[model samples]
Target: NRADGFASDSVTVLDPAAGTLTFLSEAAKLAVEEFVSRYGEGGKENFIKEHILKNFYAFELMMAPYTVGHLKMSFLLEELGYRLQDDDRFKLYLTNTLEMEELAQTELPGMASLSEESHLAGKVKKEQPVLVILGNPPYSGVSANRGKWIDDLLKKGYTRSDGYKDDGYYQIDRKPLGERNPKWLQDDYVKFVRFAQWKIDQAGEGVLGFITNHGYLDNPTFRGMRQSLLNSFNEIYILDLHGNSLKKEKCPDGSKDENVFDIQQGVAIALFIKKKGEKKDCKVYHSEIWGLREEKKYDWLLKNDIKTTDWRKLSPKSEFYLLVHRDESFLRSYEKYLKITEAFPLNSVGIVTSRDSFVIDSDKEALKRRIRMFRDEKMPDELVKQTFNLKDKSNWKLKVVREKVRKDEHWEDSITKILYRPFDIQWVFYHDNLIERPRKEVMRHMMEENLGLVSVRQVAEGIFNHAFVTDNIIESRVTLSNKGIAFLFPLYLYSDTDKKETGNPNKKRSLGSTMMLFEPKAEYTIKKPNLSPQLVERLTCQYKKTPSPEEIFYYIYAVLYSNIYRTKYAEFLKIDFPKIPFTKDYKLFSKVAEYGKRLVDLHLLKSVELDSPVAKFQGDGDERVEKLRYDGGEKCVYVNRSRYFEGITKEVWEYQIGGYQVCSKWLKDRKGRRLFLDDIKHYCKIVTSLQKTMEIQKVIDNIYPEAEKETIEFENK
Candidate 1:
């Protein structure tokens, strides 16, 4: 060791034989050698001196003006050391700038080297049977170029024998984003696992362990990453640190809290074993996040049991229900229910371009129209003029006049223009209003399927304030206004009534007992776009399949009316089901339903019909289509309206079998884009069967295989 110093303008390097030498004696060397042998190696370069000297000068030259006092010396020295130890590309340039000040100055490795010396070594020796690899990795993700570097590295590391490539390290930048930049598809901690695994493969004798963002445990974005980990690692330990740790206010008396990590954030720490064939789940011990004093990141883990089960069997929705709708009012009203169950609805307030054109509401045209209309009407005329400065006086003046008189007219045109029709909120029913006439037909209308007629046997006694609108051919609920009455007959009946209307039947209207409401299907009259008739015949060129300009409107008149009637009637299917995945709706399983050979089953519900005389009268063209003759179609159908009584709190498995239908390869050979119905049904059955087995096992354990001898008398006795 040489301890020679140099002045600012000079450079020097002292050979090992120089003055002020410091070396361990022969006896001490033997002791250190024994320790080194145990760890496998020594005699490696103590420091990459040349690399350090280069970066030191470069950092000084660049930061001379900004640095002060010891900051100048420390900054240059650290940069030089980092460049030398990390083997980064900037080392050579840094060395050129440092000019090799003195033997001692150039020998110091960068700040990173002092703390992470062992990790910086590029060499690997497989001396141990297995080593536990572990670390906390940086959690930052940012890049200027679509993460091409990451893609390149991952592609290079792929292999077939270990299923490394198939773990699904694929690019996801093509996915869509909202107004802000898309979150990085992968987090930094997961990246550490990948890098660690790569290094282990090179060494050939290490089991990787790491604590990363808890996101891998739950976020859908990491589905591929999680699958890769599961395939490679045998045992998995997940510590979910999710909760607000800090007080709502920063300090007790308006002062800042000193704890830097106290910011309310969630974290996940995972421990993965590299050796395959171990248990799938591991015993996880969670301490406070970062093991901060008095800060248990997983205090909840202590109070609540940490359950372990087959990773695949775990359900994301099991603990919480999601109601996914854009309607704020619906969400607010349902938020209370979320405490007990998970139920979220899709946004119900939707926009449509026309009755037959499109269904997507966030189209550019729609957004532009909305913003413009909001500006024109919401802001004052003087303010608008000052801001936009009218390009066309006539147009501006017309808008101003409309704003004063008929405000809606100012932007009605823009608001109505769109490529797709919007969702109609009227299609859903709330509990505020309910009336009943026919239920089955209404179901058919809403569901776009035909349901056969079924008699409405009142569960209670009631009389007809007006006639029940039922026919062997067509059925539907007639509006109170259309029935020329103020309310429903509200009839109830016993099972003994004559099949004919003329039996000694109960006539008094009863407000009790379940009464079935059935109505015919609502008819939609698509304005039949005149495309190349050839294109029209192909499903691909039709609605939702083609980019052709046409309208698609699901009229709300029927849905609104039905919802109102259903609100009034206490007779509705009571079963609560989850929202239908891959679609914007939920389902209600009818308690009254029984399988029928032809009609399947009937779920008693109060729903409205598009074919109602009143609905038809208001829309002439639609009415004609509703009444258009069908070849032997049933008059009435069962309606199964989804319930909002409970929140969704269960995870339901949804499997898709067929590809997409809009572009089925069988029909047009558009691979990767189309799906067939066969695929859908097949997948549905498989997923349903799997879920059914789990459910059956639960029932068998709870209800079956247990004897109840409370009433076991023999018939002979």
Candidate 2:
């Protein structure tokens, strides 16, 4: 599958302008075509002996592909009129490349005898495998076994022994691992990379090139790997081909985008070269190929010397997009603000009920999660029949959950429950979990206005509409839905989980959103600390001389809801939690806090009441919908929809929030997995319309001006 340099330009009578197409895969064709077009010279026979057969190599795990690979090379040779020798010494091997080397070196647990060729492949390490290691590795699931050698790789944690020596010019952020270390170093592609790096290290001077997942280039999780490459490789090139659903990025030029392969995630081509010498003062050359047709992408790769371009000449060390942040206030806030972890270190996603049918049903007389289900809130008969084997289908087995004592257990009533769902850039809280039907009048009002939560109806195209289609796809996947019938998973947190769940407190308190900060109590301890507890404290106290969490959250909220933050920090927010910006001025803090509180209220539906004219409900039984109307029904929240749609009052579903399946923000995340309707409880969305959000942003901007562009600009030098 990692075949390279096989592009065919054979022409025919049909479609004369573009020429005829070859049946060969791009990689196979590129391998042959690139050689003929760029480097083929002199007699073909001698070249085959010295270069093609000797230097060219292919490693495959399966015999089928291995045979196909051999045939491909042979076919290409024959096309050049070179007859194949009987026992051609093609480097292709029918063995699993992942473990062959290690298995050959030393016996690991479950170690088995190896064939002569496998042993030889393993022995190549001592002989120096190659000066240039290149291939496309598998990118499916992670390795099930993290054998001893792999564990060592994870713990080794730095540049290879033969690295190009660190010069600090091409470095990435590094801190001692206590916690928060990237856990994905074991991913298949990363391991292949690790293997490639090892080969180069053994050779002392070599090139490691491959087309693989582009995530390692910028994802915070792969920082150490990046740093290792920076320290070890003298020269590097990264050509990011943005197509993965995880990125949710469009073609930069507005062209239709699809993954470069059958896979849903984006891919990149990286070439790392190191010569045995002193460290060179160079950054990795990085370029991007976005939204091009499949043929054009392959053509570009074939035509370009990926290593010779200016990559990081633009934004070498900045976060994705190479944009720098120079806001003094932001810098100050980051420097001084206390992190949220200091206060409420405890945090977790809302509760996940693994078996909903067995733990819940609709009858108020029936117990679900130790509480009786409100009679009107009964699950559909079809849903119950599909999932549970109940006595008359009225009973559920909840004792295992309700009776089991766990660390964060809470009393039924006191438990903090929220329909916590991410809506695009915001975490939309749509309902409270009380397991009871709302008052009829209130339900009617909300349903009519499309503002209040209704009985869960997960059937798509019923209430919420599709958020957005990936490329041209419009189908929905059902297996991953929450209730096996509906798609939603309410956030569950116990009252006892009160001590943690912290935020970063900053001095720029003039802006605010869902963020808030409080001081670390003497009794507070770190929960799920990504950084060491010691570093957490140091980082939490870095900026302010005498740090205080005073009104920190409000300022964060203000910034979060600000147009500037959303528009600028859009990329950062997708992969990581909000790192709020704070300010020291109390006046600015309070003003921003006010806006945050208003947003909080607006989302909580505090402005409207049960009897308010805007509150309304509709339908009966399954087809029911709820709403909250304003501006004479011109604005509303369709509390129950596959996702919000459009119209002044139409609420469109946004798949980008929470990276959830309902949002479809990252299709590559759980590729081929189903999305439970129960997990998508907040199909609910709110908006008077698109312009209203913008106008609201304007109000915020007027209250406190955003940092001007001049304030953040920096010269390339």
Please list the residue runs of candidate 1 whose C-alpha ends up more than 4 Å from where it truly belongs after superposition. 1-135, 140-145, 152-157, 160-165, 169-184, 207-209, 244-260, 276-411, 416-717
Q: Write the per-residue lDDT of candidate 1 for residues 417-466, one digit (tens) a residue.
A: 11110001111110001112223212212121112121121111111111
- Cα lDDT of candidate 1 equals 0.26
Mind sharing the TM-score for model 2? 0.61
Model 2 lDDT per residue over 403-431, tens place: 23222123232222123232222111111
- Model 1 residue 329 lDDT? 30
Instruction: Give per-model CA RMSD.
Output: 23.9, 12.9
Which candidate has the top score in TM-score?
A: 2
